[model samples]
Target chain A: MIEARHLSKLYSRGVYALRDLNLTIAKGEFLFLTGPSGAGKSTLLRLLLREELPSEGEVTVAGRNLSVLSSQEVQAYRRSLGFVFQDFRLIPRMSVFQNVAFVMRVLGVPVPVQQRRTFQMLKWVGLQHRMNALPDELSGGEQQRIAIARALVNEPQLVLADEPTGNLDPDLSLEIMNLLREINARGTTVVVATHDRELIRRVGRRAVTLDHGRITEVG
Target chain B: MAALRYAVEEAVASLWRGRRSAVLSIGTIAVALFVLGAFLVLTVNLERLAADWSQAAELSVFLADEVGADQQRAIEEALATGPVVASRAFVSQSDALARFKQMFSDLAASADALDANPLPASYEVRLQPGVTGEAVEELASRLRQVPGVADVRYDRQWLDRLLAAVALIRRIGFALGALLTVAAGLTVGNVVRLALHARRDEIVIMQLVGAPTAYVRGPFIVEGVLQGGLGALVALLALGVAFWATQAPYLVPLAAALNMTAVAFLPFITAIYLMLGGMLVGCLGGILATRSESR
Candidate 1:
């Protein structure tokens, strides 16, 4: 589903965010990119998302090279992918239902379908009762669940999460991981970037560890 | 169409969120269009008055007292052959005196006290419907050169001056309207910029979620258009009220001076165009503000 050949991202003078990295993940595979600070985890995710272009190499996802896509093509490519953030990043003014339905609206889905999908997705996240509540009113765990529902509302084939449980308690983190695992079990590709090695050890998935902008180990 | 609907909903919501700036922008647009509308009203009515008088224009050729009958006949022949002359009536000296006494009864004694009847015999020559002012001037000059003609006066002279004044007013209106419209556009852009800043987080999130650039910027554009459209409405209402309020006190007397039966407001089509123009200016502002945000 994804391939990175000699992927190197250079920042300003003498600063390399990712150095000569080559990686691959098969379709429907759940993977973890574990690294310490400045280990190029988020930078790699950004490159995969086509949010940034690699300085020296190309990253391809689902068969299209990310480097050559037009502005409009980039938008369409991104619509097929889902992204979750540590901050939840939900629009504060929107209710849980609106936040989840926003993706469908952006895709120009029919209003009836949007409502139905949003309701179903909220139920799946176990936030159906809190659908009318604003993001500020929800706990960190519930907010992250709503964020997950939003990410999945458009039925994207791949979901990339950056520190998805960085703000939650241990039990809440485990719950969110379970939700991600269930999604993976349903045949969606998942890549999570985090510094939490304990969670990585428990998940027992393919883990790629990086240090100083280079891959150090793959277990 | 779906995008347009979303834009409108988002625009309305955005305007509601930034009601203060919206009101300010709308007020600015209203003032700009109102000034332009006022001049438009003036020019429209003044042109109407000029047309009315032009249809009734006449030239009066006053005859010399000692002119021979043959000289008078020659002048009459010239009037008869001229293409610009629709009709002509010869007013004898006695008839002219009689008209003076009838029109000014209180001053009849003053005319009686004058020696040798100061009024001269004249021919009142009505012009053709669509004769040019230059044609009337040429005809008047030709009449003055007639052997017995003392002087020639064309009523269209004053009408020509009035039309020139109307043109000047129209140009001034256009210039002022253009300047105000620019200012209004800038105000709209500023207001939309403020809204963009307030919703920067939302915008970033939208972009991250792969919202198209149009979807992200659509609401701001719609917000500008609403401000302009609402401003145009307010201007039209104010212009109507001002026209109605000035009818008895100001416009009535002005119409009387111009010999016009009534003063007219702006035409329905012109008002519609003004509304559309306001919206267009707003759209421009929106476009200008978001030109840099394209990703």
Candidate 2:
């Protein structure tokens, strides 16, 4: 589902975020990207998301080169995937329902369908009762679940989570991982970037470890 | 459809959140449009006044007191033969005095104190329809050279001057309106820019989530449009109130002095165009705000 070939991202004046990396993940597979700070895990996720252009080489997903997509095409491509951030990044002013329905709204889904799908997703995440609650009012675990619901509401083929449990307690982190596992069981590809080796062991999926911008180990 | 709905809702909510700036922008637009609308009202009425007077344009050839019968016959013959002359009425000196007295009753007592009627006999000559101002002037010049013709006055000359003044006013109105509109547009852009700055995080999140450009930037544009639209409406309402206030207290007497029947407010179509112009300006501001963000 994802491929990177000799991918190297350079920063200003001799700073390298990612250096000559190559990796591939099969379709519908759940994969973990484990790395320390400055190990280029988030950089890889950004490349996959097409948020920035690769300074050298290319990243391809579902057979389309991410670097070559037009602005409009990039938007369409991003809509085809779900992204969960460490901060959850729900619009602060939006209610739980609005946060989830926002993706469908941007896609021009009819209001009624947005309501139905948003409700179903919230229900699945067990946050349906907090539909009218704002992001600031929700607990850390509840907010993360709301973010997960938002990610899956659009029914994306691939989901990328960048430290999805970074701000949560250990128990909440496990709960979020379990929810991601459930999403992956439904045949959606999932890639999570984190440094939690214990959590990686618990998931027991294919995991790649990165050190100094290069993949050092894979299991 | 969904995008449009969201844009509207977001625009309104954004404006509400930044109501102070929104009001300031709207007020600027209102003041600008009000100035333009004032000129519009002025020129419209002046044009109407010119049209009414043009319909009654004629030449007045005042005769000398010692003018002989033969000189009168020569003038009458010239009037009869002129192609521009539609009709002519000869007012005797006494008849001219009586007409003046009837028209100005307050001045009758002063006229009665005179031992003799000082008013001159004249020919009131109506011109044919569509006679050019130059034609009337040329005809008046010719009559001035005729023997015993004391002075020749053509209404078309003054009417032409009035029209030239009206044209100048219209041009000035447009020039000032253009400048103010630019200011208004920039003000709206500034306000929207501030809103964009406040929502920077939300914007990043929207972009990361793959919201289309329209969904992300559409609200700002819509906000500008609302500002412009509301500004125009306020301007129109103010214009209406000013028109009503001045009509009885000032415009009526002024119209009477100018020999005009009545002054008119802006036409319905013109008011609508003014409103639409406001909206267009607001749309431009929105575009300006969003354009910088795109960079």
Candidate 3:
């Protein structure tokens, strides 16, 4: 579960990334955050992930007050949330297995458990055979799958994805969106940020729309 | 076991991610350390030589031939009894003649034709350490007044010159050491900066994941250590090359006179410290660079 109250993010004078944003996301819910570019979508995501501090108000994810958490504790909070990036941000030099194992390694998970879980997650994504392949060797769709696999490997309670389908075609985008829905069904709350209005209308999930750094509409 | 695997995995991946930068940085560090190691070997061993020569300083006082054997004993007793003298030993006239012959055989051949023992009996006196130069000179003058004492002499000039040379070498070594350390730091810093630039996106992603500062910093620190260790190994190679290249000329009598043989290279402990120091500088630079980018 994630909650934000009176949240405001002012990047600079007269440049508010988010303002007076109050929101509550229940457990196991799949939601899309959409608007045109520069809609403060990314800022909201960053704020909720504790990647950036809010200029005002509070944020709680999994019942932990992120505003009060120290930097160390903030890291613990983030570990409970899986974040997927648009760029697929896999270190191009590393193999698929290493990229997925990075989160567990950072959190100091045991080797046996890390390996077992990573392999299992890779298999779930149907890419267990590509564990040794580097990102460059994989296509766009395959790389996206690897990214999703990594996001879910830690079994996070909340999954935050920023433009997960921005670089994919309409067909690939639907496939990625479906995968996110399946992940959400498996007891993880999913928040996706995107500008694909057609896909959002078609999927018909809860949509939070932003414009010029303000939450302008909700559907 | 998991942490080890993580460290290894991270280290290898990080190295591979920044292979060109890592190799170049380590090479530069190694070259600098090699110069320092070679210079250190010479500095330490030269200090030992100077000390050896300082300890070897002793006075040779020749006694008058007319003095009777019992009077020689009296003179020896008197010299031994003096407050300024730490210890004194007498060389019999016959033994003195034999030693002189052994030292300079050609000179001894001519002296042997003198019919009598040309070398006089002598007292070799060693003063206690910390004895003032003026005090030793005055002490020698006082000893010359002793009965049966023919003459007294001490090599104060020789001892002072040796001490001065050793001091000069030590000062130079210290300055060079400090300079090399600063250079090594700068080298590592530059390398780390370049590495941070290359991995800017990766670091941003890690920060986004809310990896602890330690978690974000660990692999870079380990990378620094790897760079340092490899640098040290290269420096060792450089030291070996320099040592071997200069060994033939430095082993001659001239080299001995200048104390080259006695001046050894870097000690085992110092080598380890250099490697660690290199790693520390690399890590410090890395931390500073990433601190700016991680945000």
Worst 10-residue lDDT window, candidate 3 chain A: A71-80
Tens-place lDDT per residue, model 2, B1-295, is: 6678889999999999999999999999999999999999999999998888877888899999999999999899878845689899999999999999999999999999999999999999988866778888888888888898999988797888989999999999999999999999999999999999999988987887788988999999999999999999999999999999989989999999998889899999999999999999999999999998779
* Model 2 DockQ class: medium
In model 2, the Cα lDDT at residue B99 comes to: 97
Best by lDDT: 2
How high is the lDDT of residue B266 in model 1? Answer: 98
Among these predictions, the greatest TM-score belongs to 1
Give the alpha carbon lDDT tens digit for every residue of A55-136 in model 2. Answer: 9999999999998999998998999999999999988988999999988888888889999999999999988999999999
- Model 1 local distance difference test score: 0.91
What ranges in model 3 sit over 4 Å off? B1-5, B16-20, B62-78, B81-87, B91-122, B126-151, B252-295
Global lDDT scores for all candidate models: 0.91, 0.92, 0.78
Position B269, candidate 1: lDDT: 98
lDDT of 2 at A150: 93
Question: How do the candidates rank by lDDT, highest first?
Answer: 2, 1, 3
Per-model TM-score versus the true fold: 0.95, 0.91, 0.84
Interface C-alpha RMSD per candidate, 1 decimal: 1.1, 1.1, 2.0
Better of 1 and 3 by TM-score: 1
